[model samples]
Target chain A: MKTLQNFLFELCGEQLPSGFERMSTGAKELLAPLVDECYTDRSGNIVGYRRAALANAKKVMVEAHLDEIGLMVTKIDDNGFLHFTNLAGFSPEILPATSVTVRGVRPLPGVVATLPPHLLSPEEQKKPLPMDKMVIDIGYSAARARELVRVGDPIVLRQSCADLLNHRVCGKALDNRAGVAVILNALNDLVKMPLPVNLYVVFSAGEEFNGFGARHAAWEIAPDEALVIDVTHGASAQTPKNKAFPLGGGVMIGVAPVLNGEVTACLLDLAARNQIPYGREAMSGRTGTNSDGIAVSRAGVPVGLASIPLRYMHSGCEVVDLADMQACSRLIGRYVMQGGAVHYE
Target chain B: MIDAIRELAGVSGVSGNERNISEYIKGQILPYVDKVYEDSLGNLVAVRRGEGSRVMLMAHMDQIGLVASFVDDKGFVRVAPVGHVDPKTTVGRPVVFENGETGVFICGSKEKKEPELKDCYVDIGAADRAEALRRVEIGQTASFLSNTFETGRKIVSGALDNRAGCYCLMETLRRVKNNSCELYAVFTVQEEVGLRGAKVSGFEIAPDVAIAVDVTLSGDHPDARETTAVLGGGAAVKICDRSAICSRGIIEDLENLAARRGIPVQRDVLASGGTDIGSVQLLGKGVQVGGVSIPVRYCHSAVEMADKNDIEAVIGLLTAYLEK
Candidate 1:
């Protein structure tokens, strides 16, 4: 017996600057064969739904954002240089000399320009150049560059996912794309089995900016419960151990006042009963993910968060453990299949 | 008021781990209110039934502290701040976990120019990771050692930034009798991290008029940031802070009430910092929000200082307003 498989999984176009529609379309094409129903909403959220076999059953949604931190061209200089501002929070120290793709009239490759040490004053050399002072050089004359690129163009870091030591990988926009991968992997497992509840999968958009996508989707779906999957800081030598989780430490479950206590407890119990490795994140307030917006949606939804540990977030070379991704997917899949319950007062 | 402040200050209630303080506040205000209950977010909401306007008075019960994130093989416990923690105040200070396990904060090394949170660790006196694990598990929160003492007329203690606020609210609950309005005295959680508990409680209660009782920065200190509020200057009627603005109507109403009652009051326009007023203001359909701030010095540190006279002024004004 095939269980209800009503899920919406939206893949945001690449980086919100270039290849956004194209990448979203690619994700749809890849996921089209897996779901019973697939569609995109006005907010550009990809939705897939698998109906439960039981006539009356609870609805559960799992969401991950698709947008990545990027830059927007603010001005074009006469010397064929482009000045841009960050679309999201970015460390200035990591911007210099990084490769970027400008989604101008056509995709153009550019490099974040840096002043040579010989030209910099001692004081200027001591600090990283501020975003306003940094420029992108695409090797074009003023007239030629103006013809191809204009102000307000979106720029994305030019990097692709690459394998690392063990079952790890690093790439650009892994802060949330890795979350999308987790949903995709979980869907694969759920599609083959009968699910206990109706599932809605959302690949939300604009989480890095305003969380508009998740907010709209949550209002429309009005699910009984939701699980927001995103990235948390991974443990690193430079980061405090308490502020970050281990790379291969499975999934990080959030404990916050904003989240539903029952849902959080259920997720933890499922992890232990299933023998899936998991860690706890003590968030005093606001999970700072799509869960925040989703929790406060129409009449308020009981929301839970399962985060994948990521290192170097918002940077081009973000790293994540594939094992953790798998574990997150398994935990979500198990929670949904076991008929997750949340009391709505 | 001083006794309540000392009592609440001596309890450990860090953000996301506020059950102990929630229970304490519930027991303290139960007899005065008609009904007392806890919301899903652990907000202790005590309601005194009345037929007049629904009014909510919020005071956050949570304080800033550290959460155990990682433990090393050598028994060093790595921690992350649950709220805005100054690393300078954390160094060489004592902390107590929820289970009463104690530890001393230490910096990683002296090599770094400016020590960041990453360069800090807590020595729990465990010989190794196994022993440390037995004492404190990951995800548990620990607050600065709770201590309250008086020097002359000034009271200094940890968690006073909010416990003082709690004390003021409790004193109001006791003295305020036969009010016309439906009074909701909410002891909220997680204000140090963000105004989270009030956000949910505000949404649920939907109070017509909401006021937060919290500590405001006192510029009376020699090295303090410039602020209009000062110690022993009486209760500060907040004009505005970073998180919220006191509605003009509420300000006028409070001023007129204070003047009529002959209770001295100070106007507070804090340069920075936030309280639960912002959350209550934005709750469903909006609420006319204001704050009664107790002037506090060295906020978020172990030894937060407040004047006894200022505490009494707050208790007097709130009791008058509620009983009016």
Candidate 2:
């Protein structure tokens, strides 16, 4: 039996940038044994299905994006350095002096150059560096660079998962990988027992860029209900109490206008009944997740969101607690066993 | 000594990344010294033990360079200084990474009244971000590239600032066989980054006296800032610099030894800049410290030039001082 930390390490290590989700074979292989039927969809989402005990039963869709924010090659300079643009929104501040791997003709190690503090002017020190001014050094000449790399090739930030003292780990791509891990763990139990509803699990693509994967998955599956699992911002010293959830605070139950009120109440009630620790997040508008797209897909499918508490959402060192992930997995597992109670035509 | 200086100056040992240079120096001095070993902070300490006064000869082996930080869209790599690099001096020079990959240092901005480091980038001929990333990585360091060559009596090279000092100490270690004092020839690390290595080694091997071998600026060029030293003005005995005031006893001893040995020596009173001696002076209840510096032109630039004869004089003076 593989440890949860090792499972997360292997899952998060896969380099699945937005448009490059077809390369999610590693994740698919991991998901293969968990579901009765697992395959990659046309829209680059890994979909797994487990039939309910009764035929033609109602379906419950569970999803987490497989893609993480990364960089893409824009232009190669005459000197053989690489210029890049972000695939999704990420803070430019975390990039300097960070290490990345350019997924080109061959995987090559690269570094983001940082101007030494000794050279900084008083005024230049005050502002963050603009992305356009940054480039990656790959130690190749222009001709050799052209031979080895091409424009639009994805660049993945490389950082090994560091195990913390508590049941916590930190590394790149934990945003939805933690959610994926929760689903994988839940599927281990869901597949063995008789599920009350047809289970449709989607490891989505482009959730960091767009909601195309979830939107398409929801339309195709057209389930009676949907559950979107992802990572929510964990509160830190810098983050406000209302803006983020705390790590080790168990699962975060999403409550918003678009999310199904009955489904939200069901999840909250189940958490209390099962004694699964959970926190409530009140969003004024869209949840800024795949839930938004899935809710309105195919003349409105009701959605419920359960997120793992994660710190440093979009950097190379996003942190997540195993306890929270297990809690999220258990909550969803119980909800699936209960047959996803509230359903509409 | 000039040949050794040329050889040593060709290698890169940028501040934190001093392993290669340390290994090179360790191999070179091992045969001549009694015992040689590297310390925790990468200082190469070659000692010839004796029952006499504990004397230390410290020289920094690290050089100033740029660390790759951000690569721009056009595959141009922006860098931060690893030490003190004047953006003006670095423009249009070639830089070599530890892997021997070369890049052309160029400034991209036109809005500069005086361009700072942010305006500069290293062009490795990468066509785009992907192409550039296939070769270079972030946090990688690069040293100024210059082949060591001699014109007339002057030798020009990059990293000559402290390599010349290292060569001077290595020669003295080789020559002073019948030494009356305990000699600790330490090729220190990170002197360009505030004399870090010397501080650790100085406290650990708290000697009776410490002498830093390094390069000092010469005022022989046009619009020179320094007035007291010149390119061929022999080994400059430090009276005072920004870092430390030379011990009076050690200064007198070095000067008298130079007179007896017929070695050319001059008094150095640099208004700015410090070396390993500064940190050594403050170590272990305060050790008596002095410096023996080779006068070099264009001190921290790529084309740093030093007089061959002055390098020899420094070697002779240190050899005589240690042998006595």
Candidate 3:
């Protein structure tokens, strides 16, 4: 668990395009010696691979989107309230009164602010907050605002991660950045296991915004099967038991119309064979990851979903356990090491 | 010959939106021109009743697409590209709206470098999506402001290549003046997409002597194709290429006319892409056809610099060679 936490921390600290240049340079260096070849796509999806010794061995793809929920600078109003558009689906209520750093040539610190309750009518105050009225106030004059920050600036949470109760680590972008770390760790393990299948560790972009990057990556890199590794909400005493999977219990492996049934069965069987703990996560349809694109691809690529359990999904502070993270990597690594053909539906 | 070329280049029109150009040809020879009308595809057709000459002079009215697609609720609109829009030129361009609402192409994310056409959209200072949809629809199109200015001697800049051909047919009608042979000059729509408009027009006209007038690449630009026929080389005679293969007999006729009348002409073969001649060649029982091309630089872009002298010579050659 200590080794797992340190590995995830190093991956999280890597200057990923989570609004940073030199993206994947550090992450690529960390995953370098393990994977035989690696490259980043135009859409910023990182691709690392492990080759099979045999010529006709099965090819497998395990994907994790590199993009996370963030803010795009839409406008800077004259009153100095910075207007923002959500890069992905985000609650305006969670945004206001939250700290965020505007990433630019020079990072600018600011706070998302909302219209004063005093200014709103009692009728308006009762209503759900509108994104339009919400703005980020960096406490600068209009001229200075124009001089300092331009539109289209990437905004990230200023909140640093913390170690929560129940052996879970909390962070600003654990929604799927934690999933990115799991793939890196899985690739790290494949270095020793020498999987019989050709394994591709993919990092998708724009999954937080639009699936444009994922759709393109699926088209360009068409693998036989795609396993999207993302973070699903974990259940707690406060969370409805049925609504979310449990935190630190085990990895949540998904089964659905989106994921191939045979492929997912192999996941469950792999977990059992390796004696790795995992929970069944029933996804109704279109698992909302790069899996969505790969499922309905040209001829449809068989897919599987392996999720890292996290609490407070889509918010600033999210939690993930290091034990589940390590178990998730091992389960996927073992599956690709011996997984076979999926029966066509 | 050049007047025909200039008429096509100088006319201002956008994709799915060519009125002035279509109307200009309508008055020139609407009487002798058979079945003159606009198609659902936005192509203008002028037919000279000829059983012998199944021909289509294909040219596009659309130069490039405008930034029309918008994102409403967030104040930006997804830009729908009307034609082959270069994303590099779009970053800070001032786009003109159909209702004259002006706005700049917003690069909403600095992390994104040189947005692809689909990645970029226009943000007209609309408060929201309802206001944006009120101004622009999902399928509206516009031009990047028609600009024709003097760059140097005989060298001119504007959207011409095919429009120049559109005008050539217009003037060619007057030049062919009283020819009894059949001719069809199709000022086509969406040629930028595929040689689509001409495909339909050629299927309709099916003349015997099918000939098209379009612009071709010139070797005049610095470090250009080594085998490029130079700028102002004369009316480009198309031998063969991807889009169309000119019949040897028709090719002989045009070259004989040029040689006999002392009209300077350059022989050309495009390495890639087929033209309307590809369509005209397969019309009906197969019309024997060729093409007269004007040498131009920077095709399919704004500032499609062309040689004015070469253009005029094409008009002269088209007018003189079209005798019945």
Candidate 4:
């Protein structure tokens, strides 16, 4: 039997942009070997099914978003610079001098431009340039740039998953791609054992812009319950204690008004029984993830959220501990395979 | 009453982590009420059976505090505010964790720019990350360490904003012997973050009349914003706040009860801020809703002050109204 960690490492794919997640195709290929059936929904979500042996078994949906924050080209300037706006939340301060991959007629490399300090006045040096003021220099003339790229083309930060100091890895778009990896790994493990519930593994799309994909997916599937996996802020020297978690602390279980109390307790109890390390996240209002949209979908499905701690979110050098991802996968796999009779209240 | 307020104020019950305070309150109110239970959202619901109307009285049991999100290698812990935690009141303050570990809160920068809550950290005196992990785990909450003290006729504590209301509710539940209505005294959860607990419990209870007992800002200080409520001005009968416009019938009924019983009352019109009354007003088939507020000074800070007489007035008015 193959270990879950090995299966997850094999499932990690290229970084995907928000609203343009081709990760579903890669996910389908990985899931093809394990599940009984697989398909894609209208919203571009990938669904894998493992039918329960019993006829009256409850349907459970486990989902993770396939989208990541990126930028979109708005205009090309006379100087061959491309003006862009963010597809999701991005700190303007981190965009300067960052490398990007612009998907146009052909993939093109570009770098965010920064004004020289010598040319700037003292007051200008004190403030970071706004997103509209910043431009991407693609080493092309205005006419050449127009031929190579068009307005509304997606541009993603260029970074590959690489090892960091403490069993951690740095890359772009780890916020949700890691979550996708967890679902794939968990599903791979579940196929090895007898399943008690009808499982639906959905790799949802367009979570960064809005939860359109998750909302539609939930409405269509109408599962008894849902578990959403995403990324939460990782602890850093500068990050606030309450808003972040340690990179390797374990998976975070969300506690919020929208999340069902009994389901959350079940997940926590499963983690404790399995000796899996986990943390608690207190979401007073909206969870700001796909879970928010999925919770109120249709007749209101009970939703639970599990998040891996990620550092420098929406930046070029986003980091997460690989061990945390594995832990999250293990917890999900155990809960789905062994979680007995979940009661929603 | 003072002892109950002090005891409730001393316990830490940050939003989403109200188990400690909820259990404490369950123990205290279980003996007085006919039935006591907790909701799935951690709301402590105690019932006193009677006749006529089913009345729901709410006071949130949770308070604002810092939740440890991350711990660095050097033992410094990063925290996020559970509610509206002002950075000014957090710096240099001693914070106590749920596990009895204490830490000193500090800001990461020494610059003149106002620091956001994210720019704060807690130093728990651990030598390294491993030591810090031994004492505190990620996602654990730590509240400001403050002791209730009396100056003149006022009492000051860390969580007086809502715990004082909790004390008022418990005291009313104990004192009201001839209640004409079926009373559901609910100590709600997660009110510091939003009116979350009240939202769920209100939908379940669906009472005939609802009243939120909470602390409202008192504009008696020299620097306070313009408002009609003042310190030691008796119970502030809410006409309206940001949360809800108190039902006219409920407001008049409370005022008439106070007038007949000779209990001191003050009319309040808060410009901003909210209570659970907003959620209770919108629950189920709708219900008559109002608020009885204890005017508090320096709310959402380490030192929140409430007058003893104002607290007494709230308890007396609520008890008299229930009896009627």
Those runs of model 4 whose alpha carbons end farther than 4 Å from true positions after fitting are: A1-15, A22-24, A339-345, B1-324
Best by TM-score: 3
Candidate 2 chain A weakest ten by summed lDDT: A1-10
For candidate 1, write residues B1-324 as lDDT tens digits: 556777888788999999999898888888898999999999999999988899999999998899999999999999999999898766888999999999998888798877788889899999989999999999999988857889889999888878999998988999887777899999998888889999999989988888999999987789665455788888999866657545546777887899998887887766468889777664543467789989988887888999898888888888887877
TM-score of chain B of each: 0.97, 0.97, 0.84, 0.98
Q: What is the C-alpha lDDT profile of model 4 across B1-324, one tens digit per residue?
A: 667778988888989989999989988888799999988998999999999999999999999888899899898999988888898876888999989899998998877588667779999999999999999999999888888888999999889979999999999988999899999999999998989999899878878889999999986789665355788889989866656645657888998999988898887766568899777664433466789999998888878999999999999999999998
After TM-score superposition, the amount by which residue A205's alpha carbon in candidate 2 deviates from its true location, in angstroms, is 0.6
TM-score of chain A for each candidate?
Answer: 0.92, 0.97, 0.89, 0.93
Q: Against the hidden true structure, what lDDT does model 2 obtain?
A: 0.84
- What lDDT score is found at residue A277 in candidate 2? 96
Sort order, TM-score high to low: 3, 2, 1, 4
TM per candidate: 0.52, 0.52, 0.53, 0.51
Q: For candidate 4, give the lDDT.
A: 0.83
Quote the lDDT for A268 in model 3.
91
DockQ each: 0.02, 0.01, 0.02, 0.01
Q: What is the C-alpha RMSD of each candidate to the true structure, in Å?
A: 15.0, 24.7, 18.9, 18.1
TM-score (C-alpha) between model 1 and the true structure: 0.52
lDDT of 4 by residue, A157-222 (tens): 876567778778777777777888788777776777878888888888667755556776887788
Model 2: residue B275 alpha-carbon error in angstroms: 60
